[model samples]
Target: MAYLRQVVKTQSIDIALINETHCGPRDTSTATDVKTILDAGEAVLTAGDWKAKDPHWNATKTSPRGTQLLHDADALAFEVIGPDVPTHYPDQTAWVPDTIDLVVYRGFPGRIALDVLVDEFLSDHQMVVAELSDSTPSTTPTQPRRTIDWSVFQTTLDAAPSLPTPSNAQEIDDTAVKLTSLIQNALTAATTTENPKIIEDRLPGRLMKLIAEKRTLRRQWQASRCPRQKADLNCLALKVRRALEDHAKTSWETTVDDATTDWVRLHRLCRSLNGPLKHHDGSYIYSASSRAELFADHLETQFQPNPAKDPMRARRIETAAEDLMRQRIPAEEDPIYISPSAVFRAARLQRAPGPDGIPNLALRHLSKRMLASNGRVPRHGKGLRQSLARRVTRESEDSGTTTEA
Candidate 1:
């Protein structure tokens, strides 16, 4: 008992098993010895009649004769009890209620197992053996998988009508012309008639204002109602108006020429001015400062009746070009050069060089002329090279020159 207590306390073994204790009439002086062992504070379950040496008590108990002595012990906090089978001889055949016969120690509860009953039956003993079985919890039944009718969905989609195809460019231009004519006629009628009932009622003014306000909107509707082109048109109109206002403040004079030469000069000036020359397209010619210089040089050499006599006209063109170029290219950095060929391709691509197409060297010179300018060269080598190549191609094409490999 002392040794078992020591093992349980020091070795941390909460349960201990001692088989063949050999307690009997001759070995145990009195029943006090069994009681003394049990009262040591550990739980004890003994098999067979340890006080009887005849071995008949073990047989009568239906316990094996080999289990004439068996001791199961545990720590103070644990309890040991008989298995599901009855302990008394007469009750041995009676139905034994299912009971948890295992002795569990309090601390580290599942760590220790005495297995004394299991050991007794497994030994060479005439004991009735029973197997311990575990019961599993019952589970709920599962529902079946669901199916969908995709044909119904597809049929619903097929029943819907397709949207109308968008209107094209010719349709849009035609519409715009008709709307403009209507507005112009309304304005003329309102201005001309006596009493002008349309104006008296303010209908003509309202309608004209509405048309002006929605002219862009109408164009947008005709342009397939695309938001992107609507925005572009709005921006284009703003730029054109600004360019025209800027040009109106200048003293540039317009001169007429034969169709082909005029077209060539206009196209060249447009390239020099950066794209289509904005609102000045049908009016005055505007060129970058460098191109203006080239034109002046050309005029003096090829077309001057007398340089002294044409000085005033020459000054007017030069001054107008200079003013326009100044407004367009405000940056003080060296202007990047784009060749004439590049300008042609850009026109073909419907793209224009950024602001004025002011050549780098010319921009540098202009910057110095402006007095308040600071010059800086861009470090984009690849972009510069590409710009140069494009300009070369355009210039070559314009000059009717071809390259041979």
Candidate 2:
């Protein structure tokens, strides 16, 4: 009880129920145990269930524990919301499982969708699963991941305006970076797409379908009490059971296969299994070439040069030679360096291709080439940042020279 109290307090549990408590006739003080468990004060609600060992008492007046629960509910302002369904079904002969599971709601009254999963025979007592919600049940669609093309991103970076004129180098560089990002975004828009897996493959949908079918059959058999009808219903139930089992087995295998590191096969599998990227209007692009064209169109729209007569929005820092001294980083000093590390960090992994069909991974590989080129000081170079900028631009041009083996 102390342990449960600590757990509830730490985890902020609103409603808690205990099963198989064995709070029997010999137990001296139930108050101490209850207080120890629900010591979080009036914040949390708790409940326990008990059953009469002997068959002498009727069902309603069976256990003192149930009476205790009712007392607690009234005192603690808890609600015992239910349709009074039998929690435990009857077993073989006179041996019936006890309804020893107690449910309590801390907040306002609401219906609890509780159902016994008979197919899952966990123990002598059947497992009951409950979903707590204010509204009706919700069905969430399952989404499946698809592969992305990364190789084309580097190629796009190659064409994006890298070697801007050093006069106002900062503005030109910013424009170039934005343009590059827009193209990559467009590429990703084309290359990466998702398909929603049918809900029938997973969870309560399939299970519920089978359960409904089985129940319908059971009801029909109960109504008719005919041997031929019972046999047919039994066969259908067996078929549904087999299907459910097969779904569970295959779903596990599929998940395992997806987790494998075989990228090429996975890519091919995804492509084969899923459809192409959808347009802005939700129309699908069927072919890779079409996807590329769509990306190109988007890139043209997004990366188009600034509108004519757009304001520069810059104030001149120095008007006179005397005021020039106060200007930050004298115009003569080297322009601020954008490090190779920064560029590499910006190049995200598993990204889709750029407008030129080069991936971010491929662009990332060129960080070495940029660093190497920038290592040596050029004799004619005015500033370190400008020189590095030129080198990066040069590297972009040369990226197409060598093919990745």
Scored by lDDT, the top model is: 2
Backbone collision count in every prediction? 10, 11
Give Cα distance to truth, residue 25, candidate 2, Å: 40
Q: Considering summed lDDT, which 10 consecutive residues are worst modelled in model 1?
A: 369-378
- Which portions of model 1 miss their true places by more than 4 Å? 1-11, 15-20, 25-29, 42-80, 83-405
Best by TM-score: 2
Residue 129 Cα positional deviation in candidate 2, in Å, after optimal superposition: 1.8
Query: Residue 194 deviation, candidate 2, in Å?
Result: 0.8
- TM-score list, all predictions: 0.16, 0.28
As a whole number from 0 to 100, the lDDT of residue 285 in candidate 2 is: 63
The C-alpha lDDT values of all candidates are 0.39, 0.53
lDDT (10s digit) by residue, model 2, range 33-98: 555555544433433344322122123334666566567657756555322334443323344444
